[model samples]
Target: MEIKFNDVNYKTKLTDINITLNNSKINGVYNYNSFLKVLLNPKLIEKGNITIDGKVYNKYDPKVIAVIDKDMPFYTSKVIDEILFYSKIRGYKNNNIKEDINNLLEKFNLDSNILKRIGHSLSETEKYYIKLIANLIYKPKIIIFKDIMSGMDYKNKKIIKKLMEELKEQGVLIILTSSNSNILYELTDEVVIFNKGKVLINGSTNDIYSNIEILLNNNIDVPYFSLLTYKANNEKGAHLFYRKDVRDVIKDVYKSVS
Candidate 1:
């Protein structure tokens, strides 16, 4: 369940890049969607190689990697049709697709009536969830999300976070890219920050986010929690632990004051 990029070069778009990603953790690739393109199509790599579990990714395998991106095309008009089409192609030959789709819709808290509506007519959040279900129906080993948290509300983001945890528990490799640093800090276990087709930092999310100066130097926005923790510790002499939730930091602040 590990994917590696060994000195991968894609024309001038991506320079000599080396990354190792695996299951049991959400991997965040900062401000880069082109990496997703290369993984989806390894032939784009002019030099070096991309591998899954030590094997080169020379061919596309829908069962191996599935992407939930806005750019993913929808051929069918109806939501059900779109899901069913991908399901069939991904090899749901003899399985009860109706039951499966129902379960997926329910799992994501999607309404059953939406299945009959036109795919293009749904809201962005709804469409995203539908795409998620379509991809997850096949149980792909890896899932890549491109700019998924950008426009999402807090509730939908929470849903996605919970879903990611569930996927991690099922041993799926989750690679996500987002402009939002807060989302990345809250959701990802590991992050690889890229700058000008090269990796700036690749480490545990907590470790990377703990350094406010590095993030500021790279022009990446520091997550609020991280920034608050840093300011409290350094500026106010209030020793505080870095936490994903603001409330946890508040509790620490209370403890410090008391």
Candidate 2:
């Protein structure tokens, strides 16, 4: 499952853009409003071709591409009602919805009370996980999580990363949208960083992070771990690459100094 944008244009906002994203991979699109509206809402996609698996589409399948935008509306008052309704619509028509939903809730470490509460009653993290479960039950070929990691604590971010890893293992085409570079570096296989609504750079995480100058020029913040490592390497003549955990980075620093 690969999605490609071949010289796709939208509303004089985004110029001709070309992108190819493959299956079982997580990619980050670091952009804002105009770009997102055009990507997720196929009604606004125009002036060019958007293809899934190298074929032109008269209509993009909603089931094939799911975008879990943070601002997207939820009609149901109760969480269980909302999840069950959408799940069935997306092809989960089994009679054991309650049992299935409970399993999903447990999978995400969400409490059972989530089913009893209204959408507004849940915290941002709760909302994110529940929405994720709702979308996952649909078995979408491609899942887009919009700004899912922003404002999340490091510990919670780890849990989110694990869930994303599970999605990748399932051979799902995952796209995460965030202006936050820190999350993108750790969470995505590749990243397409946008500058003023155009592609600045789109490459593997290693390549993208290696060029700190480009990120700085675009006003994107480098991950704190990268910064510390860079400073240590520059000032103390220490060599360390940013890892998932700070303790590993510290060990590398110590080894370098010793």
Candidate 3:
């Protein structure tokens, strides 16, 4: 599945955007909310086109799913009812949906009893989890998560990371948008850096972050560990490698010092 944004211009907020996303890996789009709006709703693009598999894009595209920050309101009172409703509408082929829902609950660390509770009464985090379950039932080819990770705790993020890896193995295209550079570095295989509504650079996450000078020149935030590694190499004359985990960086620094 490929979504191509061809010369997309949106009323001065976005300009001449041309990017093609074809791979089924976890892609991190950095700091481009306006471009996201255009991708999700091509009607907002005043000057260009958004195509899915070389065809015109539409909201009803079956392969595309999004779990946004402002989650959809539950149509039914009970959480179970809401999930059932979504499964029914999305044409979920599983014969035993209740069993499937329970399995998802187990993976997400939610108790079975929570399904019987009122949907509106669930906490914000719980609501987000439910929404994700609803979308994952049908196994979309492309999934977009926008501005949703800043509030998640470490445990939640770990669960999500594992789930995303599983989805990637199943050939699901995942696009994650977050303000946290560290989160992106931890989760994304590819990174597309955007500045002031334009494509600044897009490439493999490791390569993009390794070029610290370009990011610093553009005033883009680099991952904390990457910056630390760069500073240690440049200022202290220490040879240290870039690492995602701070503990790994600490161990490497210690080895260099000793």
Candidate 4:
């Protein structure tokens, strides 16, 4: 499905933004409130004449998409039951779901016992993985993940990163949003960076992440590596992080010295 935003300006949310997005590539939008405003009202672009797969779509059709946020709570006694509820809501029948539940647990590296425990008692990763697994039951054509890495440590980020890769491989258009620049750099194919009420730039993940000055000027949290590379360039005229490789950074350090 392709979503086109044509010459759109919505109150204080958007300003003459025009972009076409479709397919399985991971796209990102950075900036907390801007991300929410866009995600919450995707149909708002309809006023500017939106089309899905080349046809006009005027109504709100969020069913074709699933927006996963960590703060969204599942109201169920047990974890497995909650998963079932969401799956059914998405049009998947029960029909012997035990094996499916088990598979999901294993896929997310979650313990089987969590399935029988309270839905709300699990850790952040557990909740996110469970919700994602549930969303997959009906196989949404598009999935939007927001703020899933807010409080995650580096190790947890890697784990979630692997899960994101799996999702990307599913042939679904994926849209992600995070305040953490590292998460966007690690998972996104392309990104749209917003400052205040307008888009600052829309570029490849590496390009946007490598633009340390612009990102810092907008007060966006930049990846540590990008910052290190920018500082290195200022100190030694060696643009190391632009290559976005740790080995390149080391090699640049050597060249700078000798």
Provide TM-scores for the models: 0.89, 0.84, 0.89, 0.85
lDDT of 4: 0.74
lDDT of each: 0.86, 0.77, 0.82, 0.74
Residue-level lDDT tens digits of model 2 in 1-258? 887877877766677888888865788878756656765665676777777788875464667878786666666888888787777676767677678678778877788988889998888778877777777777788888888866778777878788788888888888888877778888888988777657778988867776677777778778777777767777777767766577797788778877
Indicate the TM-score of model 3.
0.89
Point out the higher-scoring one by TM-score: 2 or 3.
Answer: 3
RMSD from true fold, candidate 1: 2.2
Kindly report which residue stretches of model 1 are placed more than 4 angstroms away from their true locations once superposed.
71-73, 235-238, 252-258
Between the candidate structures 1 and 2, which one is better when assessed by lDDT? 1
Q: Give lDDT: candidate 3, residue 159.
A: 93
Which digits, one per residue and each the tens of the lDDT, describe model 3 over residues 1-258? 777888889987888988888656688999868867777677888888888889987564543655555456888899988877776777767887778888999999999999999998899889988888877876778888877677789999899899989988887778888878888888999888888878999988988887787888899999998898889888999899988877888899889988
Q: Taking the tens digit of each residue's C-alpha lDDT, what string does model 1 give over 105-149?
A: 887788899999998899878888888888888788999888788
Using TM-score as the yardstick, the better of models 1 and 4 is 1
lDDT of 2: 0.77
RMSD of each: 2.2, 2.8, 2.3, 2.7
